[model samples]
Target: MKVFLTSLFLACFLLIIAPPLMAVVDLYEFDTESQRQRYHALIEVLRCPKCQNQNLAGSDSPVAEDLRRELHQMLLEGKTDREIKTFMVDRYGEFVLYKPRFQKSTVVLWGLPLVLLVLGLGIVAYIVRGRQSTNTRKMSLDELSSSEQDQLKSLLKTSSEETETPP
Candidate 1:
């Protein structure tokens, strides 16, 4: 019983700790610190094609692993950042890039927010102006003609009398 308990405890501990120990580690050595930093930043920004929502650095998908290796190899080959980005873009389309380039195809992505904001403001302004005009046009007692005022007074008197004496 003692040996069984010890083994169970060891197994539980391994289950809890082994995952973190086996986490993905970058094994590539960059030519310079700047290259290493750039590699880190690039992985964070580049989305995994297979795991659409996850960045390359955080995704454990096979595609993410392959992309990471390709990026590392490109950096080692003395490829500029722009060249590497273009290569990925050509291969995977704009979806792989977190910050997509501004082009005819992607203009809507960059411009839609501003367009929606202006449209919303315009609608609000129009509604406020309409309300203001309606408020201003409301007929106050002084604005009514003398005959209209007399009619209104008679109507109010009848309404009050009808309310006071229930049907």
Candidate 2:
């Protein structure tokens, strides 16, 4: 009875401590190298619809697996890359492709940020230069009017007299 309990405890401990093992999918099942390559390529370029951060090949989610099988079947049926992609787009929309199509709608999506960055840099440069030029135009106390300069000279004279030692 002690041995049975010890064995059960060991089994539970191992189960809790073990790292998750990933199962290998058989790519060899495809008859031709081209079919295998096409399958891999299609899966690599496709974003996992369920996990937006992962490619279909890297994600083990059911949606990714299903898409992989569909891609394999499409390759077996001799579908062109364009056809397979079109089919995926029709079923899943443009979000499935990692690189979006270069359509009018997506042009701003690709180009707007870069344009904004350039415009922002130009504005910053203009503001910085304006400030620098204003600082470079330094004004001296000697360049003031007679009345304003007299007041400054009187202030300096009073401050100097207060700091002087008696002779």
Best by lDDT: 1
lDDT by residue (25-74, candidate 1, tens digit) is 76888899988988999999899999958999999899999999999999
Candidate 2 residue lDDT tens string, 1-167: 99999999999988876645446564536878888888888889988888967998899889988888888888888899999999998998889999989899899999998999999999999999999999988888878999999998999999899889587
| Reference-based TM-score of each model | 0.83, 0.69
Tell me the whole-model lDDT of each prediction, alpha carbons only: 0.93, 0.87
Q: Please give the lDDT score for candidate 2.
A: 0.87
In terms of lDDT, model 1 sits at 0.93
What 10-residue stretch in candidate 2 is worst by lDDT?
A: 19-28
lDDT of 2 at 68: 88
